[model samples]
Target: MRQRNLSIPRTSVTALVAAMAAVLYLCLAALPVHAAEGFDFYTDSPGIHVTAGDALSFNLHLAGSNAAGSDVALSVASMPEGFTGFFKSGSYEVTKVHASGDGADTIATFQTTVPSDVADGVYEIVLHAASEGGFEDDLILTLTVSGLESGESNFHVEYPDQEGVSGTAFSYSTTIANNTLNTQNYNFSSNAPAGWTVAFSSESTQVSSLEVESGSSKSVTITVTPPEKVEAGDYTVECAATSAKEQLSTALNVKILGTYGLDLSTTDGRLSFDAFANKESSVTLKLTNSGNIALENISLTSSAPAGWEVSFDSSVIDALEPGASKEVVAHVVPGKDSLTGDYVTIMSASCDNQSAQASFRITVKTQTGWGIFALVIIIAVAAGLYGVMKKYGRR
Candidate 1:
């Protein structure tokens, strides 16, 4: 065998090696890129369904990867109008969440509220998470709000008209209903005229706030008191119920009835008078209505000592307006043999609703006939003595 010396070219070898390297580079570039291990975010329920004036809640979980732990800031990017939301961990609010290494999980709860006047439709909300380690993620949440078929409100107030006196307390029974699917705490309040006091109570216990379960009702008593000197008229009271999700108010009409009172006294400001036996005396008596309402069919009467007669000019009055006064002449006569002493008589003025009485003192004096008789007797005695003296002188 002839050993022929055959050698390959260096350029060919170089070109072959270059082609293989190019093919390897292309394969490596085509492979998928792996993300760095940091934080992963997810939720148990992505789509939530609820009714109007309802509250929805879900659990959010953060899973850690092979990288170091980081603090993730959580927030709600967008929500419907008149909607509110918050995040909580255990019993406290969670503004920032922490994720540990070694594939640990951190959980936080998210709560959202739907307003009572929200329309029936599907809404979208965005939940976002960010960290200093160049970690950012967001998830889209779906919220479905439905309305009742009967078109009834979730919260309502029931109250009726009330009536009372001006200087007294007015009370009424009210009912509040929670027709939603969640329990709610309601605050009670009212608006009234100036210088008026209002209060609320439940089951005979005073309360500023109360709690009612879902689809249930609560009985509340509202008491309103007007000012001590308020005028008699028609008034209105507005009572309200406030909660985290809804507010309701109702008006109650109040009718005020007036009070009636009468006062009786002597017109001359003297409770005593002087009279002799078998004599008649005249006195003036005054009657006044001091209350807010008018007095009708007012009658007068009197009580005197034995054998004494009392009479009035007019015994009955048709009507007496408020704060008005009337005067009547009263004629009083003593008995035939009345002794010289003080006498007391009670005069009363009465109306339909009220009455008053006053006492009068009368002092009796001796008759004039007895004085004339005593003077005649004294003159006769003097004439008789003069006659006797003259007769003796002549003898």
Candidate 2:
């Protein structure tokens, strides 16, 4: 075989090289190939808790590395119930662009306000982004929307704050927030503490569900008043709130200070009577203490007529517990030949050596005049008989 070194012409070699170059250029110029541009949607703070009157916010980002100059436009396709969407106009300037598979990152943010009446619940938002070349992608976002915590609202009493004085009054308020994609109504209630007078402005009947706009908040105030006689110390109340959507509760606290005071009453402290000599009469005295607390160590003492006597069930009362009283008796026996227009004396009661005074009075009168008449008649008869007898003898 003749190894005919058929060397191709230099022109043929150059033309072949030119054709390869032309083919490479055609492939480069034929169409602008687009790398897939995508972003993961996320909340700036993954979970959010807000009061009924609070606002909800979420920030989004397009995270990637290495790739640049690829722009992704954003739009919100779905929003939570109470959220109001607004674009931060000059805010999302394309400072930089990032590719989906790259390691470097870029961020895009959207701001939304939660209405005061937003219902409490978990919500999901969908975000959409499009490239200038008509390529579009979407990200599913999750947000947890919750009502204000018990400690955040006035109606809620937290740990260690429990217990209220018997007479102290408590006032608390509860708020409802719309945190869902729809309108919601809320119901609120309380398991009042013992010895407390509890009242709520919320309906006793099923509360009409309130219409809360998305991204808004609404509030309600509850008032509690403790009973005047509750003992001093810690007390607990269970309060709950429910909406057409959800229910939550808090343990209310109250502190009672001291015991209630006492009031005293007496039916006329003074006593009086009228009697004849050698006659007798009696009188009664009453004392009362009306209070929540006990009265200790009560006593009664008396100074009566010279021959009269007085006594008490307890001359020294041991203790008069709340709402208790005592009655004492006095006996009067007029002395023979006792002359009395009004005989007066003093009576006293000592509570722990503290004394109170009262007075007693007695009046006396004498008996009939028949004895002197009989004696006079007898003397007249004797004188008449003596005169008759003397005259008869002298004749």
Candidate 3:
């Protein structure tokens, strides 16, 4: 060994150095190399709550330690039936996120959507983020849904506006949707005008409050009755549907077009009249518009004793204003053979599907000519009888 140290050649030293380098390389190669912790997915708010028909979003942060900016694939590992989850980067929706592991482009948006018709309840979703280096993370998200959605109306009307006349019912078909996880007792109320009545009914049964099941809908009939003398115009009925957790209000329109009416009578309002047989008598008839709307094309007709004739000077009135009247001349003639007795006559006025009838009585009197003839016959009979008696005595 002393001789080798003293006389060691440069080539030998070089060979030794090369051998050591090889051994070191072998040792290093035999040892396993650990992979770096690529990236991590997390959200500041892992739990949230929203009503049905609303969307929920979470701001995600991708933290890493010595990450290689690998493409992290995002997926929802678990979700409920009523929810849909997705990832977004800015305005573009994406499923793969490129994480530099250096905190650049590490923010993402996770959004979940719920259907409007879904029932209310709590839901859980698991978001999975995976990378090429077998690095992965599962984030749990929680969601709570209230029924019918908060601050949103749960009532729908097939027809919010209705048209009718006074003293009639105006109906509105309404549908109430209980998109909740629990049953509810809904109370109804209305702010109608004075002397007006508002009622809510289901299946023809009136109800002030009703119990509704979850995820179910109920149809109700809203009946609004105007006052007796309600003016013709547009009226509003404010109604509300209130539950334990929700309240919805709506305004309904009711159009009043007035009513159709006709009044037929004498100016003095006398229902009876006396008339002689085979004589024509003229009477003044008055036609009044008893409704708030105008009346037009009013036709006059009469029903009287058999063989009697009746005529109107103005058979049809062109138009009559509300609360106004028009006078017409009606000539009535009795049958020649009619006896001295009481008779009935019906006068009718009709316009615009409205009709009014008035009844009158007539008394027929015997003609003077008939009475005079009867007296003359009696006198002739007496004179003949007396002449017969005198002739018999002389014989």
Better of 1 and 3 by lDDT: 3
Q: How close is candidate 1 to the true structure, as a TM-score?
A: 0.46
Q: Once model 3 is optimally superposed onto the true structure by TM-score, how far is the C-alpha of residue 28 displaced, in angstroms? A: 49
Better of 1 and 2 by lDDT: 1
lDDT of 1 by residue, 1-395 (tens): 98999898999999999999999999888863323324556686788677787777877776555224677788998888898899888899898877663333445778888887899999988888777687766767898887644423233335466666566788787887787656778898888988999898999999998898878988888888887667778888888888776676778787777756688887778888888777889889989988888899999999988898999999998899999999998899988879999988898888767799999889998988999999999999998989999889788
**How many backbone clashes can be found in candidate 2?**
39
Candidate 3 per-residue C-alpha lDDT over 59-169 given as tens digits, one digit per residue, 9 for 90 to 100? 877777634567788888989886787899989999887777654454579888877777778888899888876887778888787654375438888899888778888
The candidate scoring highest on TM-score is 3
Model 1 / residue 306 / CA error / Å: 23
Q: Using TM-score, rank the candidates from best to worst.
A: 3, 1, 2
RMSD of 3: 15.0
Instruction: Please state the error at residue 241 of candidate 1 in Å.
Output: 2.4
**Candidate 1 worst ten-residue window by lDDT:** 148-157
Query: Which window of 10 residues has the lowest lDDT sum in candidate 2?
Result: 151-160
RMSD of each: 12.8, 16.7, 15.0
